[model samples]
Target: MVLELHVWGPAFSLPSIDPKCLAAIAYFSQAVPKDAWVLVASSDPSVSPTNELPALKNGPTWVSQFRNIVDYLRQYSDGAWDLDSNLNALETADNTAFSSFLESRAQPLIDLSLYVSSQNYWQCTSPAYGDLLQWPNQWLLPPRIHSAAKARTAHLGLSALDLDAMEDQRKRDHSAAVAAGKIPANFIQRPRDTVSKLLGRTSHQSQFRLEALTGELFEPLEAMLGGKDYLVTADRPTSLDCLATGYLALALVPELTFPWLRDAMKSKAHSLTAYTQRMRHKCYGTAAVKVADAYPSLSPSPSPSHLPWQTPERARLATVGYTLINSLADNTPILSSIRAQNRLRQAVESSKADLSDVEREALAKHATGMKKDVLVSVAAAVGGVVALLGYMVQTGFFSHEGEEEYEEEEEEYEEEPLEIEVGEAPDAFGVMGL
Candidate 1:
């Protein structure tokens, strides 16, 4: 059977495509007994005018993965891949048990994707995924990662990759190459060096970097699946593994081109890079899924005892959280505007006269107790300007109206005594009291 796999997203490029993911597709395509075709379809509104899939260069396959437009296509296709659409269908079918089970497995993954999508709309919908996790006795988040951390010492390899030396060397080489009018030592080295320098200089500081926080999030999944071959066959690759492996390869790049992260995980060990490359190929090509002989043993101890216990998953989660917070601090340009609006709203609301006496006293006490806390939290989020602004807004400090109210008395100007109207007292200040 000829198989065609399509990627429905923003754009298409082999390098942009995760090699592992492509490898998995390639593997599956080759594994099929008869000739099979592979294709990519980009649903990005701004698709390049010149894009042409080699496989589909011949003709259309009548197969597609339309994301938001799932319903229209579902009428014709036997199966649709989107989890949201599938869950919606299941809900309609009213197969409560099956729907609940699928939801339990899929919603967390969806929530994680939304969190990492870095778009505002994603966050708006992330909470909805909570409905899938609901149960009478179950907690919102599974304790799988927590328990694994208490039991396992394995690190999720949260250490950032240091490629500064490579970057420094590449820069030096480029400067030399430019001076010498040569191709920069080696032909392949130029692009490799360029990528290294570019990635190394950029910091990983974005909401989407949460995708790399896989260790913690994958704990329940790993526990449920155990250590098993993830593809269709021991020797053949699967689309799911391709996605996973592809994402991992991108996340684990040695150079840190992504700004939301400090760096990537690096090692002098040949086997480590080799393993990554192998995984990449297997997921992206025709290579079969095979367990590496030298997978790292679980660590005996965790890093940073004060943070959290050392489960591979916990470490992963911590690393992701750190990257996200760091990104918010360093990269979020709109944060200041949002914060200013929030502060302004708070000031105006607090000036209202609806407070009960008890509430007012409690608020005062809370304000007193929170002096240090406020300084730290607000300062961190909005900087020293917050304190000044808060004071001015809260107490009417620095306000023009308040300052004008205290204008110097007329005594300073030797105000001329007003001539009273005929038969009227000197205190009469208006033309007519009537």
Candidate 2:
């Protein structure tokens, strides 16, 4: 069977927008032969067991994350698929340590640049996510991921970079202040961000902090490379190379409004910059996905010419129902709890919300849309409750809060799953091809 290496769709002229996805691309390019597998831009986290991207599928077997995918491939192929098989025990240990270092240290920096920074997120990264995903998911996933990033990096003491909600509020306040009367350029008390006024986060300090983070990650990596083309060894690439490439390529490549991460990498760490560029080019060169229809003629690009990428399996129908139902179930409670417009803005930033509009008109529309969603969700939930209560009342099938069971009811569950075999799940349920 042809193996499916499912990942997020490409953006910014990169193989995949995600760093982890990039690592998988690099690993597949090096380890898996062109004939054995296909790359898929599924662009839906719901398709995976772990609810993450860069998943590998072989029949019923499903695995995700770069290191896990490496192990899965190696074991399934019975050692033939091993990328680190050439490394000695010591080298392998080093390989493991570096992978950990990359994920833990390098990841937060990427999050900061791509998701946490208000300007970068609003201008570049969020739009990329919107383009990469389909309808409702386009609205759902970006905010969720952005929320996750903010939580992950909260302790880093860079709250200024993360205040997208407050940023919009400040813009509105400043515009109102300006409309009241135009101020002179030389005026010392010009309208400024309230949060920034209180916290006093300067760009110079943010840059300095960013540079320090880059050094912490890149210094060790550069020291290890020591002028070599690849990390861990000079001759060829390893899984470590794939991970580093994934993390560093993302840090360097994406065009961000606040490009401190990219700037720090370029200005401070020359060696790392070169190594990431090299790995990205070698591994993700001219990468294209396979489709049923041909571009120029009716043939998928074959072999090493383009890395073997395939059209992704459509999202299962069950997934769509779950997403819609789940969104209503999840969002309404948060919406109901909110008491004020400021609190509502905070809810969008904190909860599994996605809309982050850069423009004033768009931000207003986004707020209105969010309010509508909340009302719709609340109505649906209330209607369902009313319907259920009516049925219970008519049939006398329910009891009061302190009432005992009407009878001893036997607990039951389906012995069989919704369907067997995860691979054919989309076919069994239904496929939503974009």
Candidate 2 C-alpha error for residue 76, in Å: 1.0
**Model 2, runs deviating above 4 Å:** 163-204, 286-305, 315-318, 332-434
Measured on C-alpha atoms, candidate 1 has an lDDT of 0.35
- RMSD of every candidate to native, in Å, equals 23.9, 25.2
Model 1, 1-434: lDDT tens per residue?
A: 33333332111112222232233333333333223333332211112222212111123333222111232223433343222232345333432332233334333333222222222112322232232222310232223222322233223221122233444666887878867987645545434333224334553432224334433334332442344443222333333343444343443431322323212223222333344456555433323221110011234432221111111112245544543463354335455444444444453346433468787677666555545454566568776678779887999765687556456544467678899777745655464564
Write model 2 residue lDDT over 204-272, tens digit each, in one string: 575567667778998898889887877898898999999998889888887777677788788777988
lDDT scores for all predictions? 0.35, 0.75
lDDT of 2 at 218: 82
Query: Which residue pairs collide in model 2, if any?
Result: 39-309, 143-354, 290-309
The most accurate candidate by lDDT is 2
